[model samples]
Target: MKGILCTLLLLLWMITGCSNNSASNMENNKKLAEAVKQETEMPLEMPTDFNFMVSFGYGDVTKNVIDTYEGTVTKDLIIKGSATAEILFTADELRDIYDKMKTIDIMGPKELSKKGNCFQTPSNEDLWKVTVGGETKTFSWTDQKCGITEDANQLRELRNYIQHMVEGLEAYKTLPEAEGGYD
Candidate 1:
């Protein structure tokens, strides 16, 4: 009877020890996961002097431009109705732009395609100039509907994104309606 009780007590002790070890292991695993998440999810270090300029519409004569360095938006009509508005972007907004630029590898290449042709007469144009980390890249392309290069299409998307963002801002909304229409 004593032998049986001793064996049962040893088994119980072993089981308890194993459960404690399992709980410790689980805690360690959780800590490791949290540490990895903290390391990976850390916010990116934004550049100190970042500037972006996007001029879009029917060439330069009938275009609207949002220039961060100039802190101005120039809204142009075909010939006569041109207006300039003061604008400012908050730090958070700039950070968001930086994040988006990084996502699209804007600083990596001037053009993603080597051989692509686009053609349109008096076609709308999108000109993007971005400066990051003291390096500048300028991209110019025509309307996507005119069958532009792949890189130009990417720029179009970027331009559209910025235009949409600007349109939602109070400054853009306050601007007077464009006076004339392009023929």
Candidate 2:
């Protein structure tokens, strides 16, 4: 009887030891998967010559931002099958946008799309994207209400700011022809 009891204790010890080993292996595998994803992803950069780009759909009436700038900006818009319009956009604006966006944690994977049931929630939602250093980060909210989380306010502000920037373009033409426009 004593021998049988001793054998049972040894078996239990072995089982616990094996489970701990399994847990460690799982943690290592998770880390490896994250490293692989980072290594394999394609890099995105904001091109210096990126004079014009569509901000995509986030507004009610106007569909896209149009560029009146000549050279690569014009050609790219044409290729995208859009009728370009002359508007005020400057490197300063881009830099400002970059500064605002760099504060958001966009280095990790993020879900940019959200779905809502019409019956469940009658609220309107919009997705905003800002591209910098060739990378685009997206934020979406229902109407202008952002969300219930702490981070939602920051997101709402950024969205409102971008909306203002895009809307502000309508007020002026060619940015008063600054020294070398893009400079």
Candidate 3:
């Protein structure tokens, strides 16, 4: 009878211990989830002295920022497809772009790696210049290898975001389209 009682007590103790550990594990999971939620909800801050320019086009025909309020975009044509106009950004928009750049650590790479094999001729180049505080960084990358690298992909996405914003502006809409095509 004593042996049976001891076995019953041992089983009960094991079950209680397991239940306590399970409860502790559940609490830990909840804490982890909350931390992740808070982190994702946090907004990224933009630098005070931020200025940036991103441009892209085929071959030598490209676009560039002339100043804070003006830029030019040349089409992929052999003749007369360039349009110079206002390219302005609001504080909130600039902050959003800066946040994305920071998230990808754009300034971290001096040159993006050309990892995969690329045999095709050069088709396009995308350029970026960012100034924060007193430091300025400029980099250019081609569409060679179809932007296979992680850095290239991220930059492409950033460039696309900028392009979408610019194209939606009234000033950009007023620009003339290309009249000719490359040979």
Candidate 4:
């Protein structure tokens, strides 16, 4: 009886320890990161035309996909839009983002792959929209290493590069420029 009880406790401890990286924890982290982003974004009057603007975020998920860092970059600025305001970024950082953007094969596969293993989580369904001549083009991609589809290998190199670019940009979060209330 004593040995059985000890083995049960050991199994419970192992399960608890592994839960730190469990899928539930991943979802929680994404939710918390999105909440923080919403609280800190800055406010700016958008151009009158939705016909010509820029935006970027995760693609279609059954649930809203949350990224640790996601936003849009224009010629002179990076704007993280939220209900409250926009968190502003500098020209240098935005410039780097744009440069990296140039290298990414944004033209993703014609269709996304189905989910991978039961334990597998798909990579960020990255999407970006840029407007040129009043027309907006949205590009999207995701990595599902389940081997169920050929796209798991296609654009693999660019996907890796883009993942690193987003993670690196986290360190460069600059000013949170809010709208002026000058009387």
Candidate 4 per-residue lDDT over residues 37-58, each given as its tens digit: 5543322322222221222222
Candidate 1 TM-score, C-alpha based? 0.66
Candidate 2 lDDT by residue in tens digits, 143-171 = 42333333544555665675567556654
Could you tell me which residue pairs clash in candidate 1?
A: none
TM-score of 3: 0.64
Clashing pairs in 2: 44-134, 45-133, 45-134, 46-133, 46-134, 124-143
What clash pairs does model 3 have? none
Preferred candidate (lDDT higher): 1 or 3: 1
Compare candidates 1 and 2 on lDDT and give the better one.
Answer: 1
Candidate 4 clash pair list: 41-85, 41-86, 42-85, 42-86, 42-87, 43-85, 43-86
Q: Clashes in candidate 2: how many? A: 6
Candidate 1 stretches greater than 4 Å from native: 1-43, 60-62, 112-118
Kindly give the stretch of ten consecutive residues in candidate 2 with the minimal lDDT sum: 70-79
Residue 135 lDDT in candidate 1: 69
Stretches > 4 Å off in candidate 4: 1-85, 105-123, 132-135, 144-183
How large an RMSD does model 2 have? 9.6
**TM-scores for every predicted model:** 0.66, 0.47, 0.64, 0.30
Highest lDDT: which candidate?
1
Best by TM-score: 1
